[model samples]
Target: MIVNEWCMYCGECAGVCPQCVIEVCETGLKFDEQTCEDCKFCVMVCPVGALEKDEQK
Candidate 1:
């Protein structure tokens, strides 16, 4: 997943992630690629369209 500059730092994506791969804090958001299951839940839950699938990968 890719988080762009538009990210609002909301914790919604982290809360809805099924794989527990996303972590949101006061600093920023962190994505654990090792634990991610390619589940698009985070992408879907991001209200600001900050998260997206890394299509180039």
Candidate 2:
């Protein structure tokens, strides 16, 4: 899980995340990749379209 600069920190993604991978950090939602299963649920649920996968591949 990786919350980029696009995140509004509204916790919108957190709600849909089954693994609870999204957390509100000091800067914003600190995405914990350790618990992430790449389900992409958070990405779809985000109203602001904040949450996203690394997509480095």
Any idea how many clashes model 2 has? Answer: 0
lDDT of each: 0.86, 0.75
lDDT of 2 by residue, 1-57 (tens): 555667777777778889987787676777677788888988898776665588772
Could you estimate the TM-score for every candidate?
0.84, 0.74
Give me the runs in candidate 1 sitting further than 4 Å from their true place. none
lDDT tens per residue, model 1, 8-28: 887889999888889887778
- In terms of lDDT, the poorest run of 10 residues in model 1 is 25-34
lDDT of 2: 0.75
> What lDDT score goes with residue 32 in model 2?
73
What candidate 2 gets wrong by more than 4 Å, as runs, is 2-5
Give the candidate number with the greatest TM-score: 1
Pick out the ten consecutive residues of candidate 2 with the lowest summed lDDT. Answer: 1-10
lDDT of 1 at 31: 84
